[model samples]
Target: MSRYLLVVPPLAGHVNPSLGLGQALVRAGHEVAWCGPELHLRPLLGAGATVFPTGSRLFRPQSDHGLAAVRSVWDRFIVPYARFSLPAVDKAIAEFRPDALVVDQHCPAGAIAAHRLGLPWATLACSTMDLGDPLAVLPRVHEWVLGRVRHIWDKAGMPADEYFDLRFSPHLVLATTSRELVGRDFPEHFRLVGPLLAERPDQPGFPAGWLRPDRRRVLVSTGTLADDVSARFLRAAVAALAPLGDRLQAVFVAPPAELPDLPEHLLAQARVPMLDLLPHLDLVVSHGGLNTVCESLAHGVPLVVAPIRHDQPINANQVEHAGAGLRIGFARAGAADIRAAVTTVLGDPGFRVAAARVAESFARAGGTGAAVAALARLTESPVTTGPSRSTS
Candidate 1:
């Protein structure tokens, strides 16, 4: 069994996919160790992998401004991550002496550490990393922001451009997203592995009186990161769907802290696993997160997406282009708009059919198990120099 060290950003969306792949690796008779914050320990351990806590920082909201929030991810999360976690990863590499390093796409520290330690490394991209065509324009924006942040890193005595270079470069890059949205010529090393989702271990009992009811069941979730903004949208959606109360049941998977006062007609719960809930769902209202989008599609549930930031808008665009969903801009969305989007999706049976077709495609693409096999191949051959392309 080869020893593998997986380093991931502490965000749930970023970490969850890696955890799914790590579990598959463990089941295949490989030893997997995850180095991240303490919050990830339980889930990583539950997945049958060893966990090493590296950074003490928790992922808290860094800004209230919309686009500024995206920049905060780099300043508060990425910069600190590179600074604090590199030493920990370097130390772990020295002692564990892993056969290969599997890192999250954004974690340049892991990739560089593996290079310095002379071990093979690969990147598991949770979202779109290839910044070409529509995405190509992002580098100029990223560079502008990095130029400002570089000074901080320089003050901290870290090589900022070196880290950025490592982050933008990868030996092999695997994205959970499909090519439907990413355009063509996406680099030979980039592989579109269908979304890596952990198979749900059975959870006991559904919400009390949570019957399928007479109307179509629509699951509304915003994922963990954007739950606050999602909650506001849910409230608007619930208000819009109030008239269709008996005709449509809206289930909002809210965080306990942000759970809004809901009308008795609409069901509200904190932290219901979407994997366990999707089978019963006819449609989903979501933020177009990669995991949520892929999971809903995997379950053959049509979507009404409200994209806020990052790759969400891109994912929403893909869903709409594929005829599986409708994308609504969150910045301009209102009760009427949310209601109209939901009605349009539910009213048209074509959306459901398209969703099912995509679901079939995703099933054929292979999920976490395929990712595990891919990693194992990397371990056996050990791409020690330059970028290696994904044959998929």
Candidate 2:
């Protein structure tokens, strides 16, 4: 059996997909080792892969300050990613001498190490990368903006153009989304492998009165990490749906301490897995996070997306244009807009049908299994030469 080294970012969304891929690799009789923060140990070990913890300050964000949070991700998150991960991954390669390296697309250090060491490597992109094409689900402008930011970051120290040139140029880019989402013709090296989600085990039972027919079950969430905007969106959704009275029941996934008073019929705060709660949901109100959007689609539930930062606006637009959901502009959407969007989706079955179709397409793309197979193939046919480097 060949050995494989998987390098993942510390965030739950990034680590979660890598965990699924690691589990599938272990099941296929490959020895896998994961490097990240200590918190990831339990989950990685549980997947039957060996774990190595690295120092990553990005794992902890100071949520009290919004701009600080964003800055911290760029500086603390991306900087250390290059500094610590390069040496750690190189050491792992020298010691364990893995047949190949499987890394998250964001971790360019791993790609660099794989290149320098002359080991085969593949990038598992969790989000859309094609930014130029109008038909692409992820807008080109967002990519341009992010690229400029990265360039500024590089000029400060690393030279962003060279980084993208060396790290992203010729690596086999394995995306978790299908071609339907990106209209551009992908290079031969880039392959669409569908969504790489962790398989759900049977979850704990829902609380009593969690689902009430008297009110529409609206799930309000912004995922785990970036939850500040979630509160604002939730407040709007509650205000919009409150008029429905017993017709709308809003379930917000958040710590109870952070929740404010809302309509008694609305479930303001609760701790629940999104996958578990989505199946019973009538409408999902969210910040257009990838996991949340994908999970909603998986359950055939329509969305009312109020996006704030990052890829959220792109995801929201995808859902809206596809007829599976509606996008309420982050700066503009108020309670009335949130309510109207939710009502429009709930009132029409066509939205749910479109969501179901995308979910079906996702299933046919082979989910995590295809990712596992791709990794396995690397073990069988290792790419000895380093990927071509380009300046762009």
Candidate 3:
């Protein structure tokens, strides 16, 4: 039996996939643990899980949309957080002394620690931000991102001559998506293991009575991280879906206080068991989060996506390219625009067919099992796959 450590961020979308992979590792008779903020990790992961707490700090929320959001992710969160968390991650490495690590792409400190100790590690790519080279179109933006990564590496005293991209591990990169949706070829090291659909904690109870047999069901969620920026979108979604309540029931994942005067057919909640709810949904109106989008497609449910920022636009484009859904402008889309997009998706049978096709591919891609197999391979060969500075 091998001991493996999972390094993840506090975000639900990032951590959820790791939880599933960790469970699969445990089921295979291997020991598993986590390194991240304990306050968030303890609740997301149950009490049974072993977590090395790195504490927490208040970084500014990613409230900006479009290009600004990308800048905030690197300047405000990724770079600073890596610096703040590096010491703790280094300490965890010393204490855990695991055979290998599965590090989230957003948490570069984990990769740095792995490189520092010459540990075998695999990159867990929960989003498409790094895979397709989205920034390649803008040479300056792409260079800026690389500059930030290099700055972090230099600060950590890593070898300047051997600079490997922190977003990818030389050993392996487990992407939580499929080729059908990616609409592009993957690198040799990338393994498209599809969505890691596993049991999650703090699953809010859903009122089964809310569903009506006569009406088709729809779920409207703009994702968890962008509550600040999503209020306007959620309000528009409520308006768009309100008129269609007689034909369909809509569930909005938002606080009741944010949206007022909801019609009888609409329900608003802060959180819901997305995994459990997806199977029952006929259509999903989302912010194009990779987890929600992949899960919806896995259930053969069509979508109307409004991309706000970061990898969301890329995911939205993929959905459109795959003929699985339509993308609307997040900031410019009003009630009518949202309604029109929703109507188009619901009216066209082709969307459902495309969604089902993606779902079939996801099933064959081997979700958690494939990821485990890849990690297992890395453990068997513990040689340093990436260049690292040696103390000796």
**Winning model by lDDT:** 3
For model 1, residues 1-392, the per-residue Cα lDDT tens digits are 99989888777787778877877887889888887776755553464456776857665664343456556766777776777788888887877889988888667678667765557777777865223434356678667555644543464455443444454335566677666544445777666677888754433345756755677888877766554555567667767878877678887776544545665557766667667788888889888878788888888899999877766777788899989999997766888998899889999999999888888777766777667776777778856453222221
Residue-level lDDT tens digits of model 2 in 230-316: 566656666787777757777777666566676676665555666667778888888776667776876778888877655566778
Taking every candidate in turn, the Cα RMSD to the unseen true structure, in Å, is 4.6, 4.8, 1.5
Cand. 3 Cα-lDDT? 0.88
Evaluate all candidate structures by whole-model CA lDDT and list the values in order: 0.72, 0.67, 0.88
CA displacement after TM-score superposition, residue 113 of candidate 3 (Å): 1.0
Q: Count the backbone clashes (under 3 Å) in each candidate.
A: 2, 5, 0
RMSD of 1: 4.6
Which one wins by lDDT: 2 or 3?
3
Report the Cα lDDT for residue 219, model 2: 82
Could you tell me the lDDT of residue 30 within candidate 1? Answer: 89
Worst 10 residues of 3 by lDDT: 383-392
| lDDT value, residue 328 of candidate 3 | 95
lDDT of 3 by residue, 36-86 (tens): 998988888988899998898888878888888888999998888888889
Cand. 1 Cα-lDDT = 0.72
The candidates, ranked best first by TM-score, are 3, 1, 2
